[model samples]
Target: MILLDEAARHLKASLKDMDTVVLTPRLSQVYAGINGHADLLVHKLDDSTLAVAAECTDFFKNLGLHYNVMPIEGIASPYPGHVQLNIAVFGKWVIHNMKVTPEPVRAFYERQGYHFIHVAQGYTKCNLVVGRRSLITSDVGIYRTLKDIAPILLVESEHVALKGFNYGFLGGASGLINDTLVFAGSLERHPSYARIVKFLDRQGESWTQLQGPLVDVGTLIQI
Candidate 1:
């Protein structure tokens, strides 16, 4: 009732485990069936972490990650309990050097089962951390919230929308190397974005049919 009303009210909630279980029944079944298909040991990486001597997700990818890395995961939304914190980096702190972030951030990730390990860089590195051998995530925006980082502002590269999580971060790029941890969202909601719709009428990975596209679960998520 609430979800239907929200949709009718023009407000979609940020997805959660509850949403996953409720909405994507097939995906849940798929995950359950593939749960024993070799655990995917993964990692998250970025330039700031590289400069700071912290290992990036590329390191894990080159080592052959247990699973494929999807760079963008969640959608970007305002950080909680703030009026204008999400875009603050653009106006004022884009180039400023900061010694520390709000304490709530560290606490937030810690609550998400992430073990904080500070990287020591000759006093010129941003604070960052990695996952604890489980769900690999470093997006501070959606660390505990449903909001992923904005995808439009990411570095130029071809990106794919993974089937499971949208509003989250993945570590590596498609070819050059592992993608950096960045906020990625609004891939499907964009008019210019087109992905490989592999399904019934949508024959190949890349095709366009004005009539009607595949409406299966996978196609629904990507196209």
Candidate 2:
């Protein structure tokens, strides 16, 4: 079965074997108040322990994911919810490259055995991994850092959606399932559409687009 968040519910029937989860509206409101993005409130730390806002505790439990409630330390809290816990786990390292990250979150990945790579882009999930050592991102800083390390296709960020914001992140706009990279919307309108298709083709990965506007739904993890 495919696991998706409520924002993607419109694609449910089309996506075979679908299972969906929705975070409480209160959490959505809080996220909007901060970064205007829900991804800032959720993270799949690993197979277990899906880190999410406290309000989603029961929702995740019902989905059978071991929920780790992220404490809301207010907007000015030490941690920048927009980037602090929003890390990308790929290749050899958990690529965050941010100057500061919560120690507890950092420690969690350390125990998982991934070294942290310094990249200026805090929105790691926006850089979707098409294969084992390949990714697609619109973040130039991340592209420059991992270019020599992996096959990364740098794209423009104009078409992605962030709702109240100007644009959303690419990594957060799509997810990798068993053999296909699923995008929340079609890529025909993206400037990098052709390049993205070519990159995915070279990586031996297929992609599917759901019908709708391309919105960032956070990273979908298999629980």
Candidate 3:
């Protein structure tokens, strides 16, 4: 089920827990660095990511984690589904754009215990992992809606990178492992890095900055 062994190696090394991992094919030719963006390409009711998920599922299952693949289709036409599965899940909340999320995936989330909340913007990539009870985002709508129930920080999006787009998102450049939050780029360059760090520190959470620009690689999923 492995498409590129070298890329898988890099992915394994980037993860804090390597006992079992699910690797996806990369979209970027520069596979040496952490290119998680290339790996996640989910859509609504499509089989676009099925093959990769199947392979990764097998890979993880062999490691005794009882992993299974649920390949989701990416969006169609002009826009790319680079962050299709980028919805944020914590406790009973599933924060995302209900209009774009795949029905199967949403149903799966419900079966596993999650409630959906619709937001106008589909840029769920700007999320910063702060456990289920808290989250960090640049989208004003989300911040306003979830702020009362969950601890949240609204950071400006001018500093993030999206390559083809205007800017990258916070969630796309972030990943959660155990209690550590890893960012694709250094927070030092972010205008609100200090405030962002302070927010996490107060929650007893620590962050690790990965070497590279703040590219939106989509959410690094653990399954």
Best by TM-score: 2
- Higher-lDDT candidate among 1 and 3? 3
Taking the tens digit of each residue's C-alpha lDDT, what string does model 1 give over 119-153? Answer: 22211111111111111113333223212321111
How would you order the candidates by lDDT, starting with the best? 2, 3, 1
TM-scores of the candidates are: 0.18, 0.79, 0.71
| Model 2 agreement with the true structure over 99-129: per-residue lDDT tens digits | 6566666777778787777887666765554
Best by lDDT: 2
Candidate 3: Cα lDDT at 130: 45
Tell me the lDDT of model 1 at 175.
Answer: 8
The per-residue C-alpha lDDT of model 3 at residue 81 equals 46
Overall lDDT per candidate, in order of appearance = 0.20, 0.63, 0.57
Model 3 lowest lDDT segment of ten: 43-52
Better of 1 and 2 by TM-score: 2
